[model samples]
Target: MDISEIAITAAMASGFIAIHLMVRRLNFLDATPRSGWLSFAGGVAVSYVFLHVLPDIALHQREFADGMGVGAKEAESIIYSLTLAGLAVFYGLERAVKMSRGESRKAGEGDKMGNRVLYLHLVTYGTLNALIGYLLLHREDAGAWSLGLYFVALGLHFFTADFGMRQDHPEAYDRLGRWVISAAVLGGWVLGLVVDLSPVLVGCLFAFLAGGIILNVLKEELPEERQSYFMPFVVGVLLYAGLILAERHWV
Candidate 1:
């Protein structure tokens, strides 16, 4: 990547780490009090998928079909299949982690196993951040304003992810989780600079990311423990969705 691309990536990586660290410092908002913000963040993320990413994926799939002389419907089916597969993969990961946790608890190794699960989850999330960072470089030609908006949306999304992880593994997240994800964003950007992905591969990455975001956000919300504020959640959805739509029109 050139200096401009490197600067853009660095800004994004800095944003990721800064927002996360700032939120972590607010220890008073721990546990249930954080739910409203988490809900709002989830709404914003899910909106991005419905309004922005999914449409792009559809176009990419259509292009793939045309290039290969396949039926449009068939290509669409494949795209959705990949999305479902992505969802299933993360769901399986959660299930496996939970199962291991239960077994560990029974075996009197609960603390050790919990730490292991937290490590794995953080690493996986960090890898996802890296993927996103790397992908941002491809949008270098798309203008600065669009790129800025992308970082804004993603930085907000990362705030929620940080809060959720901290709630789940407070000590470990404090000790290592934050740094891991922060580094992941930078690492991913570096990798992106070194590698150019094909359209098909890019589509796959987005599909998997969309699925993961949907799953992770919802998983945090559904638990009865959250006591999330419904109105704020709806407001978040509308507010962020409007911003995204307005940005699209302005561009």
Candidate 2:
């Protein structure tokens, strides 16, 4: 099998194993930390794309990418562009969506997971995960050192994101959500290899997540009665926002 197949299979098996453990171990599963971690897994998947793996791919490809220089400056420039574009578009959509409802961030209010919003979350999260997989697995052009570093970064990011999220929201997890998220992340990672579109597709992933984040931000402004399972996603989106903004304006 090729790299894609290997990556897909490993992700599925591992994710499933994680899910199974959650199901067997947790009682009153709905209030467990599993869901938060699951939600975080998705975020971690996306972060792997945005923070480490994607940049390495982008930098390596830049050399042959329309004659772009294979220099740190060029890599920084590309990351900056994606970051700015990602954050700007995210906030813009958030504002536009909020305008219709006269929304404001009142702390603890939740966004409605309307069909549009749910679809936004799934597609964006999937796309982000897929795009990263595409660049990393397909870019046979990358060296082992950078690739190893990228994987290390991905591992740490995933671990930290999941742990922190689990700590923040002790009530969001359960066996059902745990399996669902575990399946989603692992399955999503594997599927991403197959649906591997292009580097440009990564941009679409960011855009999709940006829309969902905007929706979550709107929800966060609502009254307590309206709160839901969206805060996890909102937090993930915010992380992406921070990373992208930093990549663009700060770094």
Candidate 3:
């Protein structure tokens, strides 16, 4: 990467860390009616996945097929299978965390999660952050504009995600989780600087991220308990999608 790319990636890495460190202070997101801004962030994230990440999956499928001398159908199966695996893995983790919480409540432990469950959640999310950090340097299109778009989408995503994390494990997340995740981001970026992986592997990583993002956003929004705002979510989707399309068309 050139100096400009390095600088941008560093700034984005810092931004990710800052989001985690400071998300709790965004008190408006904790509104009872479900903050429109949080919902809006979710929408932007989902839109990015559909507009940018999913399409990139198709390209990766083609490349993987070509590289492996496999047929298109086989490549699609391979790539989509990874996506499914990503979704399934995170779903299982989520269920485990919720179940842990429920069990704690049943035991009259006041909704506290076990250390094992907490560690599992932290590890899973830390890996996710690390992959995101690695991608900061290794995106398919490494232009400054692409980096900016990515930072905006995922920055908002981190905002919403941190909110959820705090709600789930307030004490642990504030005390230790944020620092681990923040370090994971910088660690992944540093790894990217020194360790080059195959393009096919990077594509697979992105496919996993696509599935994770979809699951994460929907889980937060679809629950009746959340009382999330719908119009702001729609606005976020439309506005970010328009920006992406305009960028593609004009830039």
* Model 3: how far residue 209 lies from native, Å: 0.3
Model 1 weakest lDDT span, ten residues long: 138-147
CA RMSD (A), model 1: 2.7
Model 2 segments more than 4 A misplaced: 1-79, 87-127, 130-136, 139-147, 167-169, 175-177, 199-251
Query: Worst lDDT window (10 residues) for model 2?
Result: 161-170
Q: Write the per-residue lDDT of candidate 2 for residues 1-251, one digit (tens) a residue.
A: 37755664465346433533344343332333335443443453455454544454455445424444456575546645655565565455444435422332343334323334334433443443443344344443244444443343344343433332232223333323233445555655566557665554453344344333333333333335322245664576467546554544554
What digit string (tens of lDDT, one per residue) describes model 1 on residues 22-71? 77886655655455676777777777777777777886777758755688
Clashing pairs in 2: 29-174, 35-173, 105-221, 109-222, 111-219
Ranking by lDDT: 3, 1, 2
Q: What does candidate 3's lDDT look like per residue over 1-251, in tens digits?
A: 68877887898899999999998788878887789999999999999988987777796777889876899899888888888888888889889989999999999987767789999999999999999999999986566677788889999999888898888888899899999999999999999899888888888888899888888888888999999999999998999999888776787
Candidate scoring better on lDDT of 2 and 3? 3
lDDT of 1 at 249: 78
Q: Per TM-score, what order, best first? A: 3, 1, 2
CA lDDT of each prediction against the hidden true structure:
0.72, 0.43, 0.88
Best candidate according to TM-score: 3
